[model samples]
Target: MSYSNNAVKVFTVDPLNWQPWVETVDVKALTPAQIDVLSEAPGGLEKIGPYYALLAHDPEVLRERTRLFNAVMYGRGGLPRRERELASVAGSRVNGCTYCASVHGRIYNDLTKRTDVIQRIFTEGVDAQLEPRERAVVDFSVALTRSPERVTADDLQPLRDAGLSEAEILDLIHVVAMFAWANRLLQTLGHPTRDEVVLV
Candidate 1:
């Protein structure tokens, strides 16, 4: 799919399957003043790097919030990286963030060496093919993303049955919830993809 000159192209997916709300931003167009402002912001230089430079008009608070959110989601989780990526992928899939799904899908495949499963979830539905634990994580993520209000004790059962500890389950929920917010924020603010950044 062709994007605007200022847009970053990350993943090419069937728009009919996963519909993302916003096109990716192109960081190459950022001005020096924007870069200077972003570089000085807390965690801004690292969490988003040059991408934050593209969002020159964005409030500093929003930039810092996104940076902090990503840091926690990708960094502090005690769960296995594979498991965390699974939940992230599943949540992105449910949230219809094609960019996030593709990025996390690659990470999941790399970590688990399970490209087949990753492809299956991306092409088909998450329920199409997954192990017991994987299925539980996918289900929980989907439920949490789609209709969080509908989540009840029954929703946690599968995760519990899959032998996930309370901490893991909580972590899964937090990741899903955080990503849900992050996806919307990125969509609303038109966050740039990694491809958009121009390394200095």
Candidate 2:
């Protein structure tokens, strides 16, 4: 999925229907610094889509941000992949970032081969009833998203009780926290709509 600013393309199953809340960096005219950041992106520029393109307006920050994103969500170990994706979706849903939530939900469904829980979440929320394990993760994520400062050691007991190790707990927190930050950023900088077609 690597691509240069001059020739960018990704095979998409469907086109997005909205644009960024703020203008995105012009990938076709990326500066050298921005190009470097895009290169460090996990799958290169083509995989970044509009969100990272917009973030790339500040290359130094985007580079570090992308590195952390790739490591926390895509890197192996600790939490199961589905749980990590659940954390992402939960945080996004709690933060009311429908676009991010939906994207993660689709990935979660694909990975778990089940859409029941995700459907409940999409139709209801992070608070929608879930399996005990899924509920634990979502509860932790929702708590963090709604009130991070109030979180305490006691707040972690559920995840611990749910069979998550300390490392897994750390990964879950990272996933939720990252999405909490990113969800707000996207809410402010981008939006979803079925009103128009945007062919990337």
Best by lDDT: 2
RMSD of 2: 7.0
Off by over 4 Å in 1: 1-37, 40-51, 54-56, 189-200
User: Can you tell me which runs of candidate 2 are displaced by over 4 Å?
Assistant: 1-18, 46-48, 195-200
Per-candidate TM-score against the hidden true structure: 0.69, 0.84
Considering summed lDDT, which 10 consecutive residues are worst modelled in model 1?
A: 12-21
Query: Tens digits of per-residue lDDT for model 1 on 1-200?
Result: 32344343333332212222333233455556555566666465455433344345564654566566666566664666688788887887776666667767777777877688777877787676788988998998899899988999999999889899898887788788778876665555443343433333
Q: Compute the lDDT for candidate 2.
A: 0.75
- Measured over all alpha carbons after superposition, the RMSD of each candidate to the real structure, in angstroms, is 6.3, 7.0
Instruction: Spell out the clash pairs found in candidate 1.
Output: none
